[model samples]
Target: MKVLIITYYWPPSGGSGVQRWLKFVKYLQDFGVEPVVYTVENPKYPILDASLEKEIPKNITILKEPIWEPNNILSFFKKENTQQSAGFLNPNPTFFGKILQYIRANYFIPDARKFWIQPSVKYLKKYLSEHKIDAVITSGPPHSLHLIGLELKKALNIKWISDFRDPWTEIDYFEQLPLTKKSIRLHQQLEQEVVEKSDAVLVVGQTMKENFSKFSKNIHVITNGFDNDIDSTSITLDKKFTITHVGLMNADRNPISLWKAISDICNENADFTADYEIQFVGKIASEVRHSLEEYQIKKVLDVGYVSHQEVTKYQQKAQVLLLAVNNVKSAKGVITGKIFEYLQAKRPILAIGPTNGDLAEILKETNAGTIVNFNDVENLKKEILQLYSSFKNGNLESKSNNIEHYHRRNLTEKLAHIIKETVS
Candidate 1:
């Protein structure tokens, strides 16, 4: 079987989104499918996660098409949103940030990826004519890729699968965008259209699958999993109780109160104060900077972004890995890709997020770590002190063995099954 995957986030440009497709393509061969990837030449992605580039397979074919997004022009204007402008140079958004958001939300079709649709359709239409593909799968945040798949399904009568890394209309951060009322309705309508048209719709977590079931029966949950090769090494945990968080982080996901609590207790307790570090190693939100500033925690080490291989080393060295899920209505369905990596690390996790979602459930089942409700200062503080005491008293032990089910090859095999069933 020949499968063509359209994604906006692809390696060289890294993040959680890139890993899904990259890993899928890498493992699809085992299930008797040949994978070909279609991605944008110029992506309006937030940052370049160079670490993730190593994960891309060398043998797989990749087709890159030039994307002329209005964002290039909007970014030139240096825009700012009136409500909450970080007033910093946002990598993607410029001074015309508000204008760009307005144009993108209102003018761009289903999602901002609306810009990629025409070009993608134009390119893929021509590409498919020469290459016979068994199936086409489009994963999104750039739901525009799905729109192109929807159009292709109509034009060529080919089986198209649409994967949703996150919910479309159900995304918690939807309201944060500069979308007009009309555009919001249009976004929902377009999302439904994608749902109605696609042969199958893949969601990342169980809650996402349940949420999308109200709209389309096509939904299936094929979750994110950790790379076995990356986690195969043995790591010796350090004596100091080091809590680590990797990947892109923002204030909303950062537990400020927890940091404050840690500072307060450590100040009072010499044992707790002796050795504890909040190690953050990736793109950090300004809100996190503000919290770290407020608490004056010099131990909040910003280790910038490191390569993917280094992530394994970092996770291995830390006593407790940290998973920060945002607090949004849609957050209930969100299971971060980091959790799977954390599981593979064979270290206890200290999660700062909701206690109800799939993440909390998995953590509880896996005996991976302690989950504190988001912004629950007292509980977070208590957990920190407990961790400090455990480390100081030599009571900490690896508890990640229970989550072996989240291994990458198994997850990719699950995805392969979904694709086979969809095309059949």
Candidate 2:
């Protein structure tokens, strides 16, 4: 099977978005599928990790085109970088930035990357005509990439799969955008069209599958998995009781209650404070910083924007991994890719979100750790104290089971099966 993957995030585009298909592509050939990647030549990615380039399959066909983005121009007016990893929205935008956001939300429709869709479709339409492709997979958001797949399916009647790393209308920040009713309707209509028309719709979680099933019967839940190149046996745990979060902790993911719990514990127990450390490995919203300050918690470490290679080191060494799901209506389906790596790190996980949500289910299945609801500060404190006790006893390790199914190679084999079925 020759599958052409059309994506906005690719090699050197360091972040969660790129890791999913990158790992799938890395091991696709072992399952008898040829992976051809289509991505931008000059992408305005928020983060860069040239180290990821080494993961690309040798001799794989990679198609590239230059993309023109408005982020650089908009950044000057916004007074900050517009292309933040994991859709890091500025909570307090300047007056001029609000105007830009309005234009982006209402005018751009899906995203500013709308410009790339037509050009990509035009190029791929020609490329598909000349190649022997079994199927085409388009990943999003920038959900605009699905528009390209939609157009190609219309033009060439190609077997297309639309992969949603996150939901469309149900995304956590969908309401955050200053969108008018017409714009909202347009987004919904486009999303429906893509879901209904694609041969398959791949989502990262079951809630998304259930939600999108209203539009299509071909929805598949293919959760993200961990794929670290480093040997895990060589890495050692941190000497301090480190509770680490390895990805974007935007305003939505801020666990103010958990911070308060930790703060209270710090004041109560001097020894606990002495041995405790909190670490954030990527971009965090200012709101989170304010929460930490409001709780008067110290010993916070900001290892700003390290490469994936470095991210795993932080994960494996941590005494506890912190998984914060967005405390929003759509958060039930919002499973961040970082959680898989945290699971693979085999450290006890401490989560804050909906207890009955998808993430909680995974944690329960693996017997990895405990999850406290967003408002449960008391439980957060109890969980923390228990973890601290375990650390002191030298028995703080994750007893995860059935996690091998989430390895990159196994996931790719499933994807390969889907491609074969689609082609047949």
lDDT of 1 at 101: 63
Best by TM-score: 2
Clashing pairs in 2: none
**lDDT score of residue 42 within candidate 2:** 90
Model 1, span 1-424: residue lDDT tens: 8999998889777566788888888788988888999998877666567766666777888999888766566546643532222212243555556566667667866654576787888889999999989899998877778888998999998999999987788776676667778888888888888887888889888887776677789788888888765533566776666888898776457677677788788778877676877888787777788778888777767888776777778888888888888776777777888888888777778887778888888888888888888768888888887777678778776655566557777888888888888888
Give per-model TM-scores: 0.91, 0.97
Error of 2 at 249 (Å): 1.2
Q: Tens digit of lDDT per residue, candidate 2, span 1-424?
A: 7999999899788988899999999999999999999999898877889999999989899999988877667766643545453367677877876787788888886998888988898899889989999889999988999999999999989899999999999999998889999999999999999999999989999999999999999888889998754577898899999999988889999998899899899989999999999999998888999998898878999998898888888999999999999988988777889888888888999999999999989888888888899999999999999999999999988888888888888888888888888888
Best by lDDT: 2
lDDT of each: 0.78, 0.89
